[model samples]
Target chain A: MRGVVLHGPGDVRVEDRADPRIVQPTDAIIRVTAACVCGSDLWPYRGVDKSDEPAPMGHEYVGVVEQVGDQVKTIKAGDFVVGSFFASDNTCEICQAGYQSRCVHAELIGAIGTQAQYARIPLADGTLVATPGPPDAGLVPSLLTASDVLGTGWFGAVAAEAGPGKTVAVVGDGAVGLLGVLAARQLGAERIVVFSRHADRQELATEFGATDILTERGDQGVTQLKELTGGLGAHSVIEAVGTQQSMMQAIRSTRPGGHVGYVGVAHGVALPGEELFFSGVHLHGGPAPVRRFLPELIGLIWDRTIDPGKVFDLELPLEEAAEGYRAMDERRAIKTLLRP
Target chain B: MRGVVLHGPGDVRVEDRADPRIVQPTDAIIRVTAACVCGSDLWPYRGVDKSDEPAPMGHEYVGVVEQVGDQVKTIKAGDFVVGSFFASDNTCEICQAGYQSRCVHAELIGAIGTQAQYARIPLADGTLVATPGPPDAGLVPSLLTASDVLGTGWFGAVAAEAGPGKTVAVVGDGAVGLLGVLAARQLGAERIVVFSRHADRQELATEFGATDILTERGDQGVTQLKELTGGLGAHSVIEAVGTQQSMMQAIRSTRPGGHVGYVGVAHGVALPGEELFFSGVHLHGGPAPVRRFLPELIGLIWDRTIDPGKVFDLELPLEEAAEGYRAMDERRAIKTLLRP
Candidate 1:
């Protein structure tokens, strides 16, 4: 089976790899139907994070189960499925508390690589959610999004406590940030503001229910958001950029007693406890428990209630995986989908 | 009127000052019946905080209303009242959201010096909570405790979400931290663990309802707490010390999905964003909205349901304000009450 591997920085290549087989009694062999390059993939691609060897490249996928081990019960062979980036044993105390990312028996699918023809998914019954049937071609990107971004965005909105009559401010314009606007809207937020400088991303933000867009950064961004909310700042803030500046902006953009749901993969950031204490905002975030939201997100996508698939700007055959990585790393595409 | 003033580091003096008069339409002049030195007062007394000149000291007090401004309606002259350290209008949007500490018309009573024989309280109608009648002489200490420490401790417990069947870990041995144990017990917490090494403070903590006492500090304290909670950490952590180490211990001691309510006045602490983000715990704290809990705390005191007055270990006339400061500064007394 051919899969994507990164031997070193700026060295993504397609190579023939051993086909994955069910190992654990709870594992399932998934034949990749579609997968995509995630924003987080750029961490190593840009040389910001080091790679020791030829490591697996992808975690997001919409696949069809080709085989299942003896213990797998909820899913069967030939079932079309969407699974989270992290495989969790959903029955753990942590998973029962809706934090599957912190599940006692959790595994990162990225470690095994999903950008391949076949992959073994551990804890199949807990990690994978099946689609109603063979999904239509148009639903592929949306279902694949349920594997990570959509569920992540939904988690951000929920963490921010965005709901009826609340004003939500989003700090990034990436696919997850854009989808967060949609999630906040669906959660009944009356005012949605997206911080973005790009014209194209701003338009998509507006389309996704951002009531306003601020083309400012840091303090100026906080000022603009506060001015729009009667100088009290937004009631909820979703931080999708994990930089120190973005985190501070998100914290400052929220009013006292507000909530900040930050889902960005943190990089080189430290939050000042004094500032947060004075801000009087409730803060909670981490690698989102996407598995917790997968069922709902998959239901919403299958019913065509939300169009998260719009985030994908480029699509190609699995053989052209390098181009997909290049396009995203160079910011030429918001996301890329690869058909196997 | 005689007041407590800090001329310089270790230079507390009892000096005659001008009698306070109503300065705002919502202000009231109070004849202080009792006042006390706070843990935060030690900051400047020990020279950790700079003071260019003699500065007014003390913010916690219970007093008799001597005069009321025209706009004051809820409180009147001759009313015995227990007011929060920070006076808030309590009708603003922030106050309505239960964060009266950030009220638009909030005033720090310490600035005006509640340690004086006569003091002016701003936003009197919103700041002062009247007792059913004149408090008994024996209840004076409890009422004074409500003015700051007890209220702050209660806020910490509530912020940490201490409740039935929850395990609560308190991370300070100060008056507020000790009272937090009492508050957690009152709130129905099943297990209360207090981190204290001082024999006196630990004894008081146990008396207040601490089910366990961990004498360790820092990482070791967290390890002990985790070991006590089946290796998952406590369900709620109350941070009563405003230092980086205490804050981190409070954060580390809590399980994922737990809450941390910190009430200590933050001095110079910064939290690492990446660690906090990955910790997966809810964080909320600041200058507590003591006014929001005053009525309940007062009722608890009135009914003899809790005896928070035990925190006061020394009593002195207002004229011996210098000795009171010295006693607290030397750790010779847990707290010193001044009678004016």
Candidate 2:
């Protein structure tokens, strides 16, 4: 089987590898139907996250179960499914509390590589959500998103307490942020504001239910957001970029007693404690409990309530995974979907 | 009238001043029965928060209403009442959401000097909670505490979601943290842990229902808390110290999905964005919405269901307030009660 591998910075390849087989009773072998390059994947590829060894790529996937181990009961062979970046034994105490990413016996599915023709998924019963049926070919990209990006965006909105009468503001215009606009809209937010500078991204944001768009960053962006919300700031602010500037802007964009739901993978960022304390905003985020929202996300995509796949601007065959990575790295595509 | 005033660091005076009277249509005149030197007062007294000009001191008070304005209906003359540090209109959208401290028309009553013999309380109807009658002499101190410390502690417990078999940890051993133990107990927590090094405070903490007392500070304190909670950390952690170390300790002492309710008036603290993001803890706090809890707290104290006055270890006449401030600043007293 062929799978994507990163040898070094700027070096990606689709190489032949051993076909995956269930090595544990709790594992199942899945035939990958769709996969995508993630913004997080860029961290390693750009050498920002130093790594010397060859690393397996991809953590997002929509696949069909080809074989199941003896212990797999809920998921069966030939079932269409969507699973998260991290595999959790959904029965654990942490998973029960809806923080499956931190489940006691969790495993990063990215370690095993989902961008392959065949891959072994551990804790199959807990990680995979079976669909009503094989989804229409047109829905593949959206279903694939439920595995990570869309689920992450959904988690951000929920964490921010976005719902009826809420003025929700979104930071970052990436795939996740754009989808956050959609999530906030679906949650019945009275108004949705998105921050972005690119015309392309802004268009996608507006299409995703944004009621207002600001092409500003940092303090100016916060000022514009405050101006839009009658100077009280938004009732809920979604932060999808993990930088000091983005984080501060997100906090400043929220009103007192409001919520800042941040899904950005923070890097080298330090928040002024005094400011955050005085801001009076509730802060909640992290490696998003994407698994917690996968089921609902899957249902929405199946019923066509949302088309999160609009985030994908380029599509490629599995063999051209390198081009997919390049396009995303150069900002030529918001996201690239790869078919195996 | 006479009130406690700060001349400078290490300089305090009980000075004569004009008596207060109804100044606004919603104002009420109260004869202060009990006023106390607050930990925050020490900020300006010790020059930690410097001010050159003389400023009236104290914010917590329980007193008898001597007169009411035409608009004051819920509170009448001759009523005994407990009110918070801030006076809130309690009818704005922010107040309706229970963050009365951030009400659009909120005013910090400290500016009027609750430590004075006579105080003109504005927005009396919304800022004050009437007791069933004049509280017994013994309940005076506890009811006075309800005006600030006890109410603040209660807010911390509620924000931490400490209830029903959950393990609650408190970071700080001051009057607020000590009372937080009582709040956790009242909230039905199975275990209450308080961080304290002072033998006297440790004793007070135990009496207030702290099941564990950690003498260590900083990283060691976090380790001890996790060790006591089966290595998963406490389910709810309250931060009563506003410093960066205390905030981080509170966050680290809680489990992945746990809540950290911080009430410390954060000064010069900066939280590492990366660490906080990955911690997966929900953070909520600022100035405690003490006004929101006044009525309930007043009820608990009036019925003798809880005793919060034990936090004050020293008492002095309003004329000797300088001595009270010195005692608290020198660590000879956990809290000081000033009589008028």
Which prediction has the highest DockQ against the true structure?
2
lDDT per residue (tens digit) for residues B1-340 in model 1: 9999999999988899998887788999999999999998999998988989889999999999999999999999889999998999999999989988888778888898888899999999889999999988999999999999999999999999999999999999999999999999999999999999889999999999999999998999999999998888998999998999999999999988789999887878888877888888889898889999999999999999999999999999988988998998888888899998
Candidate 1's TM-score reads 0.98
Could you give candidate 2's per-residue lDDT for residues B98-165 as a string of tens digits? 88888878888878888889898889998999999877899999999998898888988988999998
By TM-score, how accurate is candidate 2? 0.95
Cα lDDT tens digits, model 1, A1-340, are 9999988878889889999988899999999999999888888888877877789889999899999999999999999999999999999877888888878788999999998898999999999999999999999999999898888889999999999999999999988999999999999999999999988889989998999999999999999998898889999999997889999999999999899999998888977777888898988888889999998898899899999999999998888988998998877888899887
Tell me the spans in candidate 2 whose CA falls farther than 4 Å from its real position: B21-23, B67-73
Q: Give per-residue lDDT, candidate 2, residue A240.
A: 96
Candidate 1 segments exceeding 4 Å error: none
Q: What would the TM-scores of all predictions be? A: 0.98, 0.95
For candidate 1, list the clashing residue pairs, or say none. none
Tell me how large the interface RMSD of candidate 2 is.
0.9
Question: Candidate 2 residues A80-190, lDDT tens each?
Answer: 999989899998777898999888788998899888888899999989998999889999999999999999899899999999999999999999999999999999999
